[model samples]
Target: MSTPSPNTEQMTSQPAILDQTIGSRLKETVGQHPDRLAVKSTTLRLTYRELDEQSDALAAALQALGIQAGDRVACSLGTSIAHLLVIYACFKSGAILTSLNPSYTSQQVVSALRHVDVRCYIASSDILLPYKAPVSSSTLLKSVFAACDQDDGQVSVSSVIVVSNGAPNEQAIQDSRVWAFEGLLEAHRGRVVEPATKLHQDDTISLQFTSGTTSLPKAVALDHWSILNNANVVSHLWETTCEDVFVCTVPLYHTTGITALVLAAMLHGACLSMPCEAFNAQQMLRAVVEDRCTILHGVPTMFQAFVRLRYSPEFAAHDFSHIRTGFIGAAPIVSSLREKLNQQLNLSGIGNAYGMTETCPAVAVSTRKDPDEQKFYSVGRPIPHATVRIAARDDPHQTLNVGERGEVLVAGMLMKEYWGDPERTAAAITTTVSDDGIKTRWMHTGDEGVLDMQGFLTVTGRIKDIIIRGGENIYPPEVENVLMQCPGIESVAVVGIDDEAYGEVVGAFIVLTIGTVISLIEDTKSDCIDLRQTTGLQTANDASGSVVLTAAKAREWVRTRLSHHLVPKYIFLVDELPTTPTGKIEKHKLRTQGCAALAITGAIASER
Candidate 1:
């Protein structure tokens, strides 16, 4: 067994928690800066007053349609000004908002709605058309005037609100159950709903489904208190203000896009700048220059893509100096990529925000004020009002000392519960009494991490992700972080492959930098089993397909770095690493695909 490192029970700096609903926050912002730009999109720019009145109209219309407080309001509309308005409408009408991925197919969308027990659904024509059209014409042969066909009863949806993308407002759906978003708003123009006083602060206001990195996505129900406060803390950490412009590169449906950026912007009265309906590097870069966007946000992959596009001739003339900082989340940021963003893009004070959806999302955030050593290595101290403690992996009651790795237990501003799944919710949350006799409900974050003496948290990896090779617990991130420093390696994921003798062994999936021309894996008894990949392999086409690094040299690089048991037994070269829709590396998928690939190549699954 590996020697256990120490950790700490140091609580984060607690600040006074704000008591306000989403609607109240919007109302406050409107009062403070009614004429300020609320959202800047390619087609339209909405002022705070315009947004407040417009969203109020939609909320009034929703109430007229019998959508009451606590009702679930679902939207699969792609990123647009209309989507933003819908979000505010849900907040004002006291309906539970769950913004879904617009790219989901009819079945996937239907399944999600059923899961959330949706009452109202707002969808773009792009997704609804597939379900409404015949299988021969579209992808699915489907039904409730294609999904909101309430009589069909697949979901408990009462109304289907159609949002035409850049098209004229018309009855996109012929069913009486359907209504155009523009038409509904027009009818209820100059109207406003009553304050959200009927809803309590702790009442559930939103349902955020987990990205299902390892399994199925669970709907996490967040309350007004947690969601609003989480956004407030993050907005404060980012130093967002009414004059700031935040670029929303990721989908607003996800917590990263919604809580970290969208809600943060709204809470602080900052302008949310949408360069395009979807992420486009060129357009995003142009927005920074044209719109003078001050804040930027993206996953590691998006930043990687940005690095590649930064120097392209089309964007060479554009200036990124206007970008004050950026937020990188969903995955670990490569030191190389982080540096490039800072030096080339002039985003010198980039902050790293870390939290899962269940935690109201901002448990810890690194800020510009932090020293480079602390900010870069750790994901900042826990955000205000977030209490973090490291507990023994085997025993939740045993708190670890500083530097020890264990399950990260978090409290304060957490989700109300996993929607409708009491069993799982109880299993995830545990009531713990401290030595002082104070009782706190701690969320057992499956994430494994360590807190330093100074309280800076460095997330190691997930507890399930720890590879037990020969009874030795090996963290994949430890190996992956080291491999990131190796020559020509761009991105890497480490997984535990099944082994009979040792029980399991480390395996790595590597993506090489584009134009890299080196091959390390050799066909030998002690090395990879007949990779069929020769030396001097190169990829001038794309970064995903690049095959520059080899196994022989890679093994040599690994030999001196990590523990002998930690060295990967197998290394596979791939064009691109598989990721979830939210851009997190799917390690579970990696293990399956890697094993399948070996089986296909007639390799003894285990012998290297």
Candidate 2:
């Protein structure tokens, strides 16, 4: 057992709370700024009043189809104006809105539908094709349609609304339960309906799924109060105002895009511009320049891709002077890369936010006025209505002092529960008694971090990412941060592979930057010559002699910056790192691949 810190009492405190629902907030914003630009896509633009009226129409139509309060409505569409309308319509109907990534394969989509009892699924014509073609053959689709045909009390998908930008597909129209999105809108064009039940702050509003990297995704239930209050705090921290124009490049399926960017903009009456249906660095840059966008939000890799565009000759065609503040999250951001982004994008400040899907995503965020060092080194302080602490990793009951690395715990802002999974919910959140005898429930984040005296947080790594080598705990980020600064290294992920001598050993998978050259040693055989160093190669090539040489250099670089035990024992060169739909690196996949590669080479012991 670990010892509880003396300052544990001081670490626990309350933040201001606001009681509001997403629908009420939208109504308030429309009343305050009826003519303000609320949302914009490449071809469509909607003012506050226009958006509210359209959502009201859609809400009435949904009610006509038997959707009621607390019903689950899932949307599997790209990020567009239509997507936003569906989100607000669900809010007005008091329905729980759940989103599915359009990029998901048919089987993955079927799996998600099976996991949650979705009542109505909204998709674009492109996305609905797969389901409509084999409606009778697909067990999932047939079951859903059959349930709709009968008046059964069981909760099941009753309708699939297909949103088409142009003409509706004839094949899709053949299905009895399937309906065209435009027809639904036109049928109730001027109609509006009040929700059956009064909207409450505590009413569940969303069922977001976790990015299933290691296991199947779990449904996280978030209430109106948690999401609205969290968005209010995040927008305030970003200094968002009515005049701020935000360009959203992240997908709406993720909380970062919806709660943080979409709802935050709505809370402040700010304009939101969607650059494209999906993320495109050039399109995002063009949107910022064309729309005079003042704010931007994306993960680190998205920003990295945008910065790389600066090297293109056509980069001068767009002006980025209007961009002032933005948010970066979903992955680690190295200090050096952060500096380059700030310098290249000409951003006055870029904040780093930290949270999971369950927190409605922004528990902590940096301010525009924060120093460069703070922005680079920490994920800033907890937003209003949220508190954080570093608890002992092995013993959750014991809280650690400032600067001591341990599991990160959060309070105040949290999910209502994991939808229909009480056991998992109970495991993640725990009730604890502070030193003063006050009781509180903290979300046990499973992530490792340290807190500074100033209340800033530095996330070290995931608890699962810890490598236990020779009885010593080694965090991959510590070593990764160092290796990232080395020359020619583009991106790196470190994982633990099973070892005979040391229970587990560190393995690093590296992606080299374009144009990086690895000179061959004079004595190397003809077959061993570096064939992977072709200039202008855009994608990752097979592991060759050049990869071996680059890995050797990387090992030496780590030896100089970290302890001997911290250095990676094996290194593999790859084209790119596998990522979840949300852009987070999938380290578990790397561990499996790394172990297999090590075994094939018979280098488990010799590599060291």
Candidate 3:
């Protein structure tokens, strides 16, 4: 028999379309609200007119230096007015903007730069100093410092611009290809030139790197339409308006900060406030209170830090009544923590958004007006112009029922493609034809979730994060949620560890609340207990007898709330949970550490 022809009908279309790029939108806003406050940073503040004109000047300078359309310009600076300006400049000049986390080490930055084939490298003084020695001989530096020879094998950066407020680096000053950010602006003063190439809405605007938890970070190529439309939906969901002020607590490199916070704010003519160079709990809280910010955006860990600081005497003096709404995502949020955040942060409402860098970062988001249960427990319905469905883990063609747990499939406003990696992009995105002849290309989220009848989504866990022990599947978030209700537990992460008999078993790493104590009792069979006691076992032997006893209690705690197979067999107490730069608990790291700790303590043997 011959294979049947696939359906050619297209999936449902968006009700509305955005024809303009983010740069065009900025220009429109500038024309309408020239005097409106666009951004406020710790060191500088800019209005719409100033931001547009300044970015225009920088774009002219970059164009004069030979940057052209489709060329990639990488910014390795923290959240500042200069960073925002550079972003707009890249957009205005029709150059692709690639953001690198300022926290990245020199080696990591170099690897990223090589992968993206960056044309221009921009950084603040502090961020550039660390790379001066390592990248000194690279093409980027050789442009400025003729003494440094460039290697033909390396993908060389053409120009380097350092934004410095204090003393300029003598080395940077002497380099011919390098220029001070201030000098570039001064050089192009009053010279505003339009981009050489005409930009379309579908033109690639940015290449954002993923957090790279499981493997090397992939560069997601986002078009102007995807980003701008996604931001429009997110801003509307947050009830953002021209009168509101948004305080950004996340780094600009992340999707949550750029698409959801910065771009969303601009789309609605809302003011954006940068608390500090990076996320500082005190500084963020002060910004909220001082700027009278009506909205706030952060990951769960950032909000947790704020809650911790809320108890301090210094925090009591600050008034957070101005915070009307906030967003918490990029990690699992338990109900208990959600309640505490709403209360402590004085937020009238809180939203939970879910997406990856591949979807311009937001496919599903909970609105402020959603029911408490949905807002706190579920990552609400798909945003407008987007479609989401649950499919069987092993088969993409088989769609699951509303309540059945499966991999999440999203369509609409998806990334153009993963930059320079068509193989991986093809693997992540697949086309499916329905019985009715509707065809849709879905982005396989690789995340496990269940969609209820009301269309709300409950993300169970990552497909790889599921713990299968003795033929039973265990979702880590299910266990983590139950464990969070236990007293004295500040944060917890459940991971699967190798087991000789069961293939894999549940293991948990927990962080205790400050000042909470766990009493240790020496096991008579262990001779090292005495040595451990002398070495401050509380800080050192997190897998000691005391931890084992606490583990027993935790297992019991889970036993009452979850299935017997779901209870963690091994538990380790640590001062802090290992997290990525974006504040997500690094489960793979925990799995490695937990396996080693279990081997030394013979916890696996006990389980057997």
lDDT of all predictions: 0.76, 0.77, 0.77
Task: Give the alpha carbon lDDT tens digit for every residue of 84-135 in model 3.
Answer: 8888898878899998877666666777777888888887765422113323
After best superposition, candidate 2 residue 429: deviation in angstroms?
0.6
**Predicted structure 1, TM vs. truth:** 0.88
Candidate 2 local lDDT, 1-608, one digit each (tens): 54443222222333356777788888899999999999998788999999998989899989999999998898877778888989889988899888887766666665666577888888776542211331212344444565555665454677888777544445443576777777898898888769999989888888888854347688888888888788877777677899999888778877778887789899889998987776777888778878898888778778877888986886756557777787888888887788888777776477888999877777677767777788888887777677788888788888787779999998887988988889988988989986999988899888888877677788888888889999999988778888888888888888898999999988877777765644334222221112133332222243342432345566679998888898777766677788765678899988888777666566534564
Clash counts for all predictions = 18, 1, 4
Q: What is the clash count of model 3?
A: 4
Model 1 lowest lDDT segment of ten: 128-137
**Candidate 1: global Cα-lDDT?**
0.76
Model 2 bad stretches (over 4 Å) = 1-16, 128-155, 165-173, 211-214, 317-319, 434-438, 517-549, 603-608
Q: How do all models score by TM-score?
A: 0.88, 0.88, 0.89
lDDT of 1 by residue, 471-545 (tens): 988988778877878888878889998887998899988877665655432534333432324433433333465
Candidate 3 stretches greater than 4 Å from native: 1-15, 128-150, 165-174, 211-213, 317-319, 433-439, 522-535, 538-549, 601-608
